[model samples]
Target: MDLSLSTRTEGERTVVVVGGEIDVYTAPKLREQLIDLVSSGQYHLVVDMEGVEFLDSTGLGVLVGGLKRVRAHEGSLRLVCTQERILKIFRITGLTKVFPIHASVEEAVAATD
Candidate 1:
């Protein structure tokens, strides 16, 4: 499936809502968006992944890379993921400790503040 990314700013945070499968092919799109946001000086980024139906290792790597970039700039990266399978992957990889995973976008936005 084709990947789509939508950006929105909530207060001081930039939220990127990602939809569709996030695999080797579509991971680059997400990486590009993250880089754009970081380069634009928007350090506080929240990735809303509720619309994502599938995620692979490449997708996870993109997220980890984004987190590192944000931290390097003294910013933060949060994730909004409601998918059980995805959550399991994060938990297994110990990314749940690395990233603040929220149940909804509202929660993530609130945490950013």
Candidate 2:
């Protein structure tokens, strides 16, 4: 399936609303978006994946790369995802410790760590 991504500023954080599948083909789009946001100095990011239908290893890599980018600038990258399937991927990969996952965009934006 195709991937969709839209970004918006929420207070001090930028929220990237994502929908559809994020596999090898579509992961690059997400990687580019995250790179653009960080390059433009919007480091504090929240990737809202509630609309995400599927996520593969490549997508997880993109997220990890985004996290690394933000962290390099002393910024943060959090995730807004409540899907058990998606969450399971993180848990299984032990990425739940690497990234802070929230249930909502608001919670992610308000988080301080």
Candidate 3:
């Protein structure tokens, strides 16, 4: 699983662009990175997943976990998922209700406001 993260700060929000497969092996790394960002007091997080090719339960867990953490801090988390397969996972797991899904990174970032 290859992962690359790029962060763009806008106001009080931070959009983290994620590119690569998000699986059990790589989910922890993503979780850690997100946790670090949240702990740093950057609560509004947008995960850009346009480049992600795969995701498993671990990846979903990471996103859910981050959502919980952000909510606890009175912050928010949004996702940009365009892949049908990945979108299906969220739908099947009923996570579509838990997260605000965006068509693109720009939309996700704008939603943070």
Per-candidate Cα lDDT values, in order, are: 0.93, 0.95, 0.88
Tell me which of candidates 1 and 3 scores higher on lDDT: 1
Candidate 1 regions with alpha-carbon error over 4 angstroms: none
The top-ranked prediction according to lDDT is: 2
Residue 69 lDDT (model 1): 94
Q: Per-residue lDDT for 19-45 in model 3, tens only?
A: 888898888889998999999998999
Model 3 Cα shift for residue 43 (angstroms): 0.4
List the pairs of residues colliding in candidate 2.
none
Residue ranges of candidate 3 with Cα displaced over 4 Å: none
- Candidate with the larger TM-score of 1 and 2: 2
Cα lDDT of model 1 by residue, 1-113, tens digit = 78989999999899999999999999998999999999999999999999998998899999999999999899999999989998998998888999999999889999833
Give RMSD (Å) of candidate 3 vs. truth: 1.3
The global Cα lDDT (0 to 1) of model 1 is 0.93
Cα-lDDT of candidate 2? 0.95
Q: Go through the candidates in order and give the clash count of each.
A: 0, 0, 0
Q: After superposition, how far is residue 50 of candidate 1 from its true place, in Å?
A: 0.2
- Model 2 agreement with the true structure over 1-113: per-residue lDDT tens digits: 69999999999899999999999999999999999999999989999999999998999999999999999999999999999999999999999999999989888988986
